[model samples]
Target: MRNIFTKLCVAATIGAAALVAAPAAHAVGVTAADTHPEQATFTTAPAGEVSIQAAGDGTPAGAIQWYKNHLGSTGWQGLCEKAAENSYGVTGVWASANAHWNGASPKHTTGTPPAGSFVYWNISAYGHVGIADGSGGFYATSVGGAIGHGSSVSYFNNYRGWTPAAVPHQ
Candidate 1:
């Protein structure tokens, strides 16, 4: 196990080095035309985890489900407004997802992001965020256009890690 771990570590280091050496920019997935609101489709096999809830009333999972259903149909601004967003896209998504949290307090989670875990990428001043579909990809706005495959995004750099803004109200 130790030898295997060491090999994996070495491979990861080499991969990182290659990325640093690459020229130009590296996008996560193929984008349509560099526009606002995208609907990304994942190439990776879906992660077998049903994290998002169908009747979410304000939680990370609910928000993800909402995005998954409304992305291409509603668009980013529309979805943000629907999620009761009063801020930027990323912030609005997080707000909407966790708005109905009935827990002690909303907190961000770290480490390996599980399904329903809100994910983010430090792209710009506001950054971009979404919920993991348990799959490698996520359901988020500003991808191809609508909330969809996160890995299928064009700018997959500047990973700011992930967090949980809220859990389901129970």
Candidate 2:
């Protein structure tokens, strides 16, 4: 038993090192172009404008800001409005899927960023935001606010699979 544990520890160290050396890029089933129709005109919301809400108010700006604020604070600086244009196609899709949050898309319990995982991407029309709780069911916060805003960390996905995105900071 001790030997097995020792081997597992060594393997874990190597796995962690590999992840650090060659971080895995965020890849979902959907493509960036297919996800956001207005990807060309999208951008990150302003800092002061960003807010956390508990529902979708239709206004893109509010929801965008809320998501950015809640998605944790790591590698989420210098976020611009136009950043979502070509930067985060799937990011926008994920936000949209979450907006509905009706078990529409595909989601998994075994694969997710983690509870405090931070994902870097520009949500279409909304702008850049991070991942709060990465799991089968997670919740995101932004400035414009949305259906799941102001909630005590709701699951982003309800078993619906995750969409594709360029998650720079996974």
Superposition error at 48 for model 1 (Å): 19
Q: Against the true structure, what is every candidate's RMSD?
A: 17.5, 15.9
List, residue by residue over 3-84, the lDDT tens digit for candidate 1: 9999999999999878423123222332443332333463322465333334254555555655554444323532322332
lDDT by residue for model 2 over 1-170, one digit each (tens)? 99999999999999976842311223232223322222111134467655444212233333343344434322222232212211222233334323422222233323554433233333343333333333322233232222122222222212233333323221
TM-score of each: 0.46, 0.22
Quote the lDDT for 164 in model 1.
50
